[model samples]
Target: MTDLLEQAVLTARNLPAERQDDLARMMLSYAGYDEPVIDLTPEEEADLIEAQAEMERGEFATDAEVEAVLSKFRP
Candidate 1:
């Protein structure tokens, strides 16, 4: 029961239901208290590392690539 967390809960209480849920999810994610595991094999890990290196080198898609994916699921 940290003072910061207690204050956050008190603040969230005044939010609308959707906003409250979004805030709760963000808080839990920040705290790393929610456990969702993604298991990857050694080769998959290597592939991911390579991909990340490429991204760091700016060898990646632009904002258009992301928006195209998101547009499909837009409500």
Candidate 2:
């Protein structure tokens, strides 16, 4: 393995089981494996459904609203 990947594996080894599993999924996907990487919780699924409903109803932020949020990060 590459030096960086060896180091990353060491770091990941120290993470919690859930976090390690998440990293493993990402690495497998990057290695060209076709598999589902994410398993969403019930609350997350509900949030996605609500977001879809909002989108279907044409509810969206205005351009000025977007700029207002972005301008906070400008130098």
Candidate 3:
């Protein structure tokens, strides 16, 4: 098999039983076999809710702050 395929098989084999299905699904979706499924757990849902609340409360940086952050990566 190709190096990439061999690596994928090895990585999948190392995942926990619960995670192997997720990994397989992701690989299938990446290869265009199916739409990606997002069966989020409770913690993920809570994090999304908290992020939305923060946005609504204006808990964000200013334009200058954003630019300063992006400047670090600019060539």
Best by lDDT: 2
lDDT of each residue in 1-75, candidate 1, tens digit only: 999989989998999999999998887777666875567999999999999999899897779998999999999
| Whole-model Cα lDDT of every candidate shown, in order | 0.89, 0.93, 0.89
- Model 3 clash pairs are none
Candidate 3 segments whose C-alpha is farther than 4 A from its true place:
1-34, 41-44
**Candidate 1: which stretches are off by over 4 Å?**
33-75
Ranking by TM-score: 2, 1, 3
Clashing pairs counted in every model:
0, 0, 0
As a whole number from 0 to 100, the lDDT of residue 49 in candidate 2 is 98
In model 2, which runs have C-alpha deviations exceeding 4 angstroms? 1-36
Per-residue lDDT over 1-75 for candidate 2, one digit per residue giving the tens place of the 0 to 100 score: 999999999999999999999999888887658865577899999999999999999999999999999999999
